[model samples]
Target: MGMEQQAVEIVETNKPVILQGGCLCGAVRYQLSAKPFDADYCHCKQCQKSSGAVFQVWMDFKREQVTWLKGEVSEFESSDNVRRGFCKQCGCTLSYRDTRYPDYFTLTIGSLDEPSLIKPNYHIYTSNQVKWLSITDDCERYQQERTS
Candidate 1:
């Protein structure tokens, strides 16, 4: 239910491994390649408003592993070719896709049963960071978007 710090077993080698995820209602299910890359947290207003929480965690993985398990997902065109996929029943975000990055899909890290395996590597939208919530000096903080 909260951010995990414990590591999950690495079920595979460098080769593609099955990674599982689904919505809160379990209506929409998906699988992605294991060994996610560039796991991070977003603090942008749109993300805060969309999640209605402190922040959103995301893990980048190859898109080929993602698929609809049970039913269809409602999509919102969040950005250029980037569609936000969520379950119609639970209204839980499943993943985000962009044809530009068709090879990589950014999956919600919070959706993972083992979020501990993935930790926030960077913080985005530090310029809009809440005054009451201070950013730790340990990790990189970008005032705006950091492509790198």
Candidate 2:
């Protein structure tokens, strides 16, 4: 079957699907036991700086759902309670975690083996988005992080 057909089958089956991904240098690899949720594009300054892009696409998963299949990521305390993970060997950004929400974990959409499987449902921190960037998507926009 084609890629689209395979994706549809995975969703229709309603079974736990493991998504695999890794860093640029292949030094770090991981797997998600469950499908990710709350996929969104973040335009926050932190995300822009960390990703070196106009915005960063991130998806949320439960901490328990993540497994380090290969090497572990080195974390940097980006903010008071927020830490970002990267592959030390290649310096590829991999994940994010906020100590305040220990149960939640986030992964960069670009790092996924099949990045097209996840789609951004909304945009966050739009207020900080670059002035030159124009987002025309119909997805919901939040001036900052979503409270609900």
Candidate 3:
């Protein structure tokens, strides 16, 4: 059978439907059972530093939806309110979690196996975006964290 057909069959079966991914060194693997929400580009300084980029694309999912399939991640309290998880072996940032929002996790889109399938719907903390870095997309832009 075709790959697409096999995927459909896997979904139709009672078997787990998971989106798999790992760190640069393949030491930390993960699985997501459900699609993420609130995909966006974050220009916050913390995101920029963690990703070593002008901005970071992140997607949110319920904490329960994620399952660690391989090596465990090393977590650091990036700030008083946020904790970031990454692969200690390769320093590949994987996720962000807020102390206030324990039920949700923010996963780095770049870490996904098929990142192109999930597009950022908006830009957040745009006020902190680098002056030289400009957004051309018509997607909604928020000067700070999105209220909605």
Candidate 4:
């Protein structure tokens, strides 16, 4: 089953879901009150550089749904209006935020305490994907950002 289905099953359980996670050094911790949405594998150049990976899995949540339980993430503007968050202690990429979407916050799936609980539903920015890497998933592929 997909991550979306898994998340739905979790929510349907009627239990209070408090998803928790942190940075590599355990210095930056967070909790999510609600399940995340728009989970995808991003192949944008910025994502690749920031994550030091061919692609990065990210999921979006309403800003209010997330609470910092421990140290806060240090952010750097990756582009004109886009900011990326990371732990200062261990430099683990944590989040991505765009000024255009002030109400939404995006988190790296690798930062989650249970990364297996979520999965990428699609692939974005395929135009920038590495030539050596091959994506064999059946998920939708977008050359750029997925237009709703």
Candidate 5:
């Protein structure tokens, strides 16, 4: 699924806003109680391989904001800093976590029940994007991470 070009700022307050979603097979159900942040399209090679797509759209929410309401997920240590979570039954990418940000968990936007609520603000790792792929969006494109 393609994300909107507009950047969305999510601020989490004491009050929780429930965002419900799950896997394709309904084997994994979850709820996020806080606003999400850093929603972006990542063109990194690892993300392309993990999602089997040209790019992956991800959004970060506080670790405490997420509640797994149903089945457990299988995890793969994709890199020294990245651990990816997928539904065991459906083999759908569910979540992503980087060791550098232990307090946050990034979820695949395609798995969300309300994906339209969030929009990608930028493109990360644009240097690694597939040669055949052309990005036409007006969003900011970073050579690597946003910080870099």
Candidate 6:
């Protein structure tokens, strides 16, 4: 099953009026008011290349809720539907958005104001996951395309 069918979305909070996050060199920072709509791990080829790692963990929230608090970012248009934001100084990824999904943007889990609050509900593209690294938890795993 795909994420749309298997993943259960957790309702976000409205009362938490603030969340803080920053880049590696602290050159860029961001703030958000709404809780994440989805937190998941992606193991796609693009994610591997973008992060220089096996996978990427992300926390998605409303685009309107995110605010740049410290510095500006240089963006790259990844696709017709998505544009990525990163700090030019430290090359730290802050946020990303899909033109088709204009209402929300996904942030790297590491960029969370408090990293502890982010909880991944699923892992996508497990077919390409490194055998040496493992996830011991019970989150749902997709072998290939999430829609498969």
**Cα RMSD, each candidate:** 6.6, 6.8, 8.2, 4.5, 5.7, 4.0
Poorly placed runs, candidate 2 (over 4 Å): 1-17
Stretches of model 5 off by over 4 angstroms after superposition? 1-18
Task: Please give the distance, in angstroms, between residue 46's alpha carbon in candidate 1 and its true position after superposition.
Answer: 1.4
TM-score ranking from best to worst? 4, 2, 3, 5, 6, 1
Error of 6 at 125 (Å): 1.4
Task: Supply candidate 5's per-residue lDDT for 61.
Answer: 75
Residue pairs with clashing backbones, model 6: 20-113
Q: What's the distance in Å from true for residue 65, model 5?
A: 0.9
- Evaluate residue 30 in candidate 3 and report its C-alpha lDDT on the 0 to 100 scale: 88
Ranking by lDDT: 4, 2, 5, 3, 6, 1
Using lDDT as the measure, the top candidate is 4
Candidate 4 residue-wise lDDT, 26-89, digit = tens = 9999999887866888999999999999999987888999999999999999899899999999
Candidate 3: residue pairs that collide: none
Q: Kindly list the per-residue Cα lDDT of model 6 for residues 3-27, writing each as its tens digit.
A: 3533434336555535688888898
Please say which candidate is ahead in lDDT: 3 or 4.
Answer: 4
Higher-scoring candidate on TM-score, 5 or 6:
5
Error of 2 at 123 (Å): 0.5
Clashes of 1: 1
Span of ten consecutive residues with least summed lDDT in model 2: 1-10
lDDT of every model, 2 decimals: 0.69, 0.84, 0.80, 0.85, 0.84, 0.75
Query: Which pairs of residues clash in candidate 5, taking residues 3 or more apart in a chain or in different chains?
Result: none
**Residue-wise C-alpha lDDT for candidate 1, range 12-96, written one tens digit per residue:** 3565445677788888776665666566677888677667776777777656656656777788888677788788898998676
Error of 1 at 67 (Å): 4.5
Give candidate 2's error at residue 36 in angstroms: 1.0
TM-score for each model: 0.77, 0.87, 0.85, 0.88, 0.85, 0.81
Expressed as tens digits, the lDDT of each residue in 119-140 for candidate 2 is 7777889999999998887787
Better of 4 and 5 by lDDT: 4
Residue 47 deviation, candidate 6, in Å? 1.1
